[model samples]
Target: MTQEDPEIQILLDQAEELYSSLLRGETTLADATCSEILIKLETAIEKKKHELKQTSKTSQLC
Candidate 1:
């Protein structure tokens, strides 16, 4: 895997954690700020999800 790829995953994980914290009242940022990371995390999640989806699809076709 690429080195930068892991960094992206790490940030996505962190963003997810922050989102959870905000949901539980552990974070004090405004909704916009919290939502910002949430958006990024969702995007990253989608990228990974797409990769998994393609992998599964290819394996099935194989």
Candidate 2:
């Protein structure tokens, strides 16, 4: 694991927390707010996953 691995994990952790809140049905945000934040977090997670895969491939080549 690298510095980014931990950082991305943190983001994932936070996202999960938010998801839990959303799941609990306690949030008052409109559809726009929910969709925007969820999209951002999902995109970040996907990007980090892709980066980690690339890093792993590069490491294997070394």
Candidate 3:
């Protein structure tokens, strides 16, 4: 498996922290707001992963 890029890792870390806070009831975010934030973060993470994979493939072919 390929290593996660640092930029992606930072995003993942932020997502994890947000999730943890939500689980602990530390935030006042509404349910809909939380869902939207999570969805956006997930989408970003997926896009970053795809880009990393594509970059790695291109590098291998160089």
Residue pairs with backbone overlap in model 1 = none
Candidate 3 wrong stretches, greater than 4 Å: 1-34
- In angstroms, give how far residue 26 of model 1 lies from its true place: 8.6
Q: Per-residue lDDT for 1-62 in model 2, tens only?
A: 32656655665666677767767886555643566556766677788788879989999999
For 1-62, candidate 1 gives per-residue lDDT tens digits of 22547756677677778878878998877863847666776677678779979999999998
Best-first order by TM-score: 1, 3, 2
> Candidate order by lDDT, highest to lowest?
1, 3, 2
Better structure of 2 and 3 per lDDT = 3
C-alpha lDDT of all candidate models, in order: 0.73, 0.68, 0.69
Q: Return the TM-score for candidate 1, rounded to 2 decimals.
A: 0.53
Q: What is the C-alpha RMSD of each candidate to the true structure, in Å?
A: 4.7, 4.1, 4.3
- Give the candidate number with the greatest TM-score: 1
TM-score of each: 0.53, 0.52, 0.52
> Per-residue lDDT tens digits of candidate 3, residues 1-62?
21545655665677677778878898656863556556766777788778879999999999
